[model samples]
Target: MSDATSARCVKCWVHGRVQGVGFRYTTQHEAQKLGLTGYARNLDDGSVEVVACGEGEQVEKLLAWLKAGGPRSASVEKVLTEPSQGDPTWTSFKIRY
Candidate 1:
């Protein structure tokens, strides 16, 4: 129950034991389930970067999930988010290598 104006985007830098634990892939799955479009990748600093764009409520849901420790394998310590206008052109979520 949303319109185009309800769409939003955010960028998150997740810290902790995120990389090497299927974090990016798990994020893709979660984003897809929420009908979000964006990418997740492992940063050189051992953090996971995720950019999600979709309905405001769904995006918020994804943020909560990410903050709550993401996948079972991930030990998310902290997640920093910002209002970054992610690529709405991406029709699906993906794990950037």
Candidate 2:
């Protein structure tokens, strides 16, 4: 099956100075570099939404990278784990906006 909107996944809301600092792009790079498929987008609430739709060991690596404050310009103070229903039409990691 394709990596559809209902893929097994982990969601995260990366907080603190995350926007406008290439967080989405950096995340896309990370995800793709790891041979994973997902999407990263900016939330209006000053946070970035990320999803890694796979398994624990693999997905957690992405989550760990996020919790570690992705990309230098973005000062990630906290990463909020959220429930994910996955996303639309994304075959590989990408920036949503």
Best by TM-score: 1
Worst 10 residues of 2 by lDDT: 1-10
Which window of 10 residues has the lowest lDDT sum in candidate 1? 1-10
1-97, model 2: which lDDT tens digit per residue? Answer: 4443224677888889999998998998888876677888999999998887764456777888988889999999999887576665657887777
Name model 1 segments beyond 4 Å from true.
1-5
Query: Taking the tens digit of each residue's C-alpha lDDT, what string does model 1 give over 1-94?
Result: 5654498999999999998998998899999999999999999999999999989989999999999999999999999999988874689998
All candidates: CA RMSD in angstroms? 2.1, 4.5
Which pairs, if any, clash in model 1? none
- Where in model 2 is the C-alpha error above 4 Å? 1-7, 87-89
Q: Per model, how many backbone clashes are there? A: 0, 0
lDDT of 1: 0.92
**Superposition error at 20 for model 1 (Å):** 0.7
- Give the Cα-based TM-score of candidate 2 against the true structure: 0.82
